[model samples]
Target: MTTLTVGSHRIDLSIPAVMTIVNVTPDSFYAGSRTASTETIAARVREAAAAGTSMLDVGGYSSRPGAEDVSPGEETRRLAAALEVIRREVPELPVSLDTFRAEVAERIIRDYGPCLINDITAGEADPSMFGTAARLGVPYIAMHMRGMPDNMQQLTDYRDITAEVCSYFEEKMQRLQEAGVQQVILDPGFGFAKTVEQNYELLARMHRLTGLGCPLLAGISRKSMIYKVLDTDPADALTGTTALHWECLRQGAAILRVHDTREAVQVVRLWRKFRENS
Candidate 1:
């Protein structure tokens, strides 16, 4: 079995864990999770912690396609504020920064004690990100995105999604290791730049990515792949999302980044019970 250590928290990989989403920006594609205020953000984080979320992923800038860009200063400002609130409310909760800017990562580490770095760019946008993660000795979530958020949807014509994604991770892992990055987490980026069919195809073939020898992080909660396929909206895709999370956990997903912490925690609970009985 594998394990992930963040701060003093050690998460077992034998059973899948939930990573609650805390989007502190209004531009996130999913309207339900968008909140720019620090108080509301902390409340959500506290709720997730109380509900038993194993990790709390706090993102300052939304990476949704065509998302309006936020300057580094603005991102730092928002991230620092949100993180400070969460830190004060729940001192033991493990906080992760969802940012691609090296400066933002460095600033958070310098300000906060030690937080995980969840970069959507996978060190592609800023080469120094890996070095900084290594320097700070924090866990890194290296996701696979074909292009920047603004132009990603326009580049969803991949001939072979799995092969291309595996190749991308191979190269990215090499660069990050060369930069001395200690812990690494891999995310397939479900809907960032994939068609509905391609998204399902990726999910069906997700187990193939384990060849990279890293823990898998799946973020398929209420994305367009489910809502669009179910003929519903993000707010109405919770059932579909939970249904898919089962398949993801079965396919070796170590972490599930989701909007609903209680539901996901319950999912993990029942899944572990079933798995144990089996």
Candidate 2:
């Protein structure tokens, strides 16, 4: 088992672990998962933590395509409220802040002390984010995407899907390392920059990314990568997410960023049991 340390928290990734999505905004793609109030957000965090979620990703901004953009102050307020409640309720739970803006990250991490930063832009939005990660000394989740939330879907122009993504990460890794950020995780950003066919193609060749030598975080939960192909909505995508989660685990993924923590935990446990007997 491999354990990833960010700050003082240790995420045991020797097996694929589940990261529960705790959206503190109203505009997240999943309507059932949004919790904005302090009471509701704290209750959900405790419940998910008890349900075996290794980390809770609390995002105030919705990165969904064409979603409305929130100001840095608004995002900070929402995250601050949620983090305060979580810290009061369970201070030991490892929490990750999902944002692409370095300014927001700097402010929130200073006020709330988050252990990890999961940026969807992979530090592309602002070049200063890598230096911010180094200064904070937190594990940075570098995701691959083509553009911002508003125009990303339009920028999906890729000739060689796998090679291009690997090349992007190679360049990003070099840039981040030069900036002195060593602890980084790679997320392929399944639906951010690909067609449904390209999503599966990347999953089929998922092992190629493990060659980067960083922990792999697969975030296909309720994403368009699964639901759009199934001709279903986000609420009905749990089973499809679990199926793909298992496939990712078998392919050597270190973490699974998901909305449904209980189902993901079950999948990882069952996969481990099956492997042991096989």
The digit string of per-residue lDDT tens for model 1 on 50-128 reads 9998888888898876678899999999888887888798877788899999999889878987888999989889988
The lDDT leader among the candidates is 1
Please identify model 2 stretches exceeding 4 Å from their true place: none
Each candidate structure's TM-score, on Cα atoms with residue i matched to residue i, is 0.96, 0.97
Candidate 2: residue 174 Cα off by (Å): 0.6
Worst 10 residues of 1 by lDDT: 1-10
Candidate 1 stretches greater than 4 Å from native: none
Pairs of colliding residues, candidate 1? none
lDDT of candidate 2?
A: 0.87
